[model samples]
Target: MSTSGKKATATALAQKYAPQIANKTVLITGVSPKSLGATFVTAIAVSSPALLILAGRNAAKVEETTKAIRAAAPHVPVRFLNLDLADRESVRKAAETVLSWEDVPSIDVLVNNACIIGSEYKLIDGCEAHFVVNYLHPFLFTNLLLPKVLAVKGRVVNVASDCHRWHHIRFSDLNFDVSVSWKISQKSAAHLHPKQNGKIYNMWQAYGQSKTANMLFSLALARRLGGRGIVTNSVHPGIIQTNAASHLDPAEIPRLIEQVELQCGLANQEITSYKTVDEGTATHVYAAFEPGLKDHNGAYLLDSHVADPLEDPVAAWGTSEADAEKLWRLSEKLLGENFEW
Candidate 1:
C-alpha cells in the first residue's frame, strides 16, 4: 500500500545500490539465454559484483547467459555450475562445489530462480515433477548452501509469483492425480477444449501450488533466522514471455486466462499484463540488494516494494504461518535431513 505511482525500474535500483552490489558474491539458479533468470543476471552484472555463479541443468544454455554478461561487463567475474534441480545428488553436488571454492568462501546473495511449468504428469524420484523441481529441490539446495550464506549474513531471494494466489498448498495430496477431474463451475469449464474439460492438470494451477510453497519456504526460513542478519524474501517478478512458459501453446493463452478468472471468481477483471524481461527482473534485483530491505525479512516483494496483502490481493493461505511451519517440517521429512537454522 505504500507503493506510490509506478514500480521502480531495475536500472534505477541498480544505480542506487551500486556500492552495495559491487564486490558482493552473487549466485543465481535457472540462468539461461532469454530467460528471466538470465535477465536478472544481466541486470546485476552492470554493478560489477565480485562473483556471479550461474546454476542450471543445461550447460550450453547456462554458458550463453554467462557469455552475454561477459560481453556487457567484461570485468565482472562469472562462473557456472552444473545443477539438475530434479536430481537430489546433482543438487548436493552443486552445493558442495560452491563450498569447496577456496577463492570464494561465502555467497553474499543466493537466488533460487529455477523452475518448470508443465501440464504433463511426470514423476522425478517418485515425486511430482513440478513440486520436485520448483519447490522440493530448491528447498534442498538452499539448505545445503545455508552455511555459505551464513558466512556473510547474506540474502536469499526466492522468485515466487502472484499466481500463487490461485491455489493453496495441497498438503493432503502434494502429488495429486493430474488425470482426475477438478471440480469447477460450468462457466469456467466451458473455456477449456472438450478434451481438457475435466482434466485437473492445468499447468498454471500446478505452478501456483509450487510458487505458494516458495513463499512459505521463505517465510519459514525468515522466522528461523529472525535476528541472524541474513535476510530472506520471496518476489513476484512481473509476467514475461520466457522459456519457462514454453510448454503452453501460444494460441491457448486467452482461454487459459479465462479459465483462471472463472476459477478464481473474478469474472471480467483484467488479471495480468506482460512485461519486458528487464522489467520482470526489477523485483528480483530489488529483493536481493536493496539495503532498505535488510530489516524486512520474510517479506513478499512485488514491483520493487514489499507487497501489502490488503492492496495486492495476495491469498492468506500463501502467507499462513501455520502452513509455512507445516511445509518446513514436510520438506525436512521428504529430504530425510534436519535443516536446523
Candidate 2:
C-alpha cells in the first residue's frame, strides 16, 4: 500500500499458494485491440488453456485480439465475445455466453483489467465514469459470473494502482459536479497557468480517483470472496502506460483567463512511466497462470510478489456483508431497478 510515486522497489512476490494453475481455465478480462488487455490475453493463450475467451466491447477488436491469441497458440481452444462491462445488458449477455460453455469448464483465473479515464464528469447510466469504469463494471461482471467462476475456485486478480493514494472515494460526490481536481484550483487557488487551456482537464485527478476506486473495490472483493475458496487479491500493475491515459481529450487550446477559471484543464506529458505490453501484463500474467503461490488467496501483490505494506496497512476496503450490501444497493441505484444484479 505504499502510495509513494515510486514503483515497487522490492522484487520478491509471495507464492505460498503457487502451483495451482496446472491445466486451469483463465480469463483475461480486457482483451481489447491495441491494449495491455491484448497482451495479457496473448500471454495466457500461450499457456494453452482448455478454453480462452478474448472479450471486449468492440467486435473487430475482439476478433483482432483473438486472432493474435490464436496465432500464438494455434491449437488452444479460444472464443471471442463482445463484452461491455459498463453496460448491464452487455454484461448479462456475456454471462450467458460464459455459462453456456461446453462441459461447464470451470474458470480458474479472472483478471478485472478493464478501465477508462474520463475527466468530463460524464455519467454511464447515471454512474460516474471513474466509479463506473473502475469498480462497478468489474463488480457487476464478477457478481454475475460467480457461478461460472466458483466451480473452479478461481483466483480473481484486480489491476489496481498506487496512484489510488492520491485520493479517496468522496462518497458524497462520486460525480465531479462538486469534486476536486488539480486542473483549475490548488487548495482553492488557480494553477500556475491560468491563461492556459487543455481539452482534458485535471487528468491526474480523474485517473487518481479511478485508481483509488479500483483498490477499494479489490480489497472489498478479496475479503468477501476469500472465504469461499475463491482467491481474490489486487495488484498495482506497474505504470505500463496503457491507452487508459489517452482516454482523456488531449488538446491544448488557448483561452481567456476568466473563462479558463471556469473550466481549466491539463496537458499531460507525452511520455509517461510506460512499460512494454508484455511488461505491463507481468503482474496480471503472474496472477493468472503462473504456478508458485496458489494458496495465498487474499493478499496484495506488487512486482509480481506479495507486497505487504512497508509500514501501515493501507485501507483499500473490506467486503463485509454490510459493505457488500451497500455496494450492491448503490450499483442498483446507478443502473436503476430495471437492471439485474
Best by TM-score: 1
- Which run of 10 residues does model 2 get worst, by summed lDDT? 8-17
> Could you give candidate 2's per-residue lDDT for residues 1-341 as a string of tens digits?
21122332111111222243336566766767657778766655554567776667778767887788779778777777668877878887987888887765678777788877535656676656667767877777777677777787777777776555444554434554443454644324332323222223354455565666555555555556666767676777765546765543333221222233333232222333345556555666556644444565555665666666664224344223344445556665765542331
TM-score of each: 0.89, 0.73
- Residue 262 in candidate 2 has what lDDT? 38
Give candidate 1's TM-score.
0.89
Clash count, one per candidate: 0, 11
Stretches of candidate 2 exceeding 4 Å from the true structure? 1-22, 179-203, 247-273, 290-296, 311-329, 332-341
**Candidate 1: stretches off by over 4 Å:** 1-7, 178-200, 266-272
Q: Against the unseen true structure, what C-alpha lDDT does each candidate score?
A: 0.82, 0.59
| Per-residue lDDT over 129-171 for candidate 1, one digit per residue giving the tens place of the 0 to 100 score | 8888999999999989988899999999998987787677766
lDDT of 1: 0.82
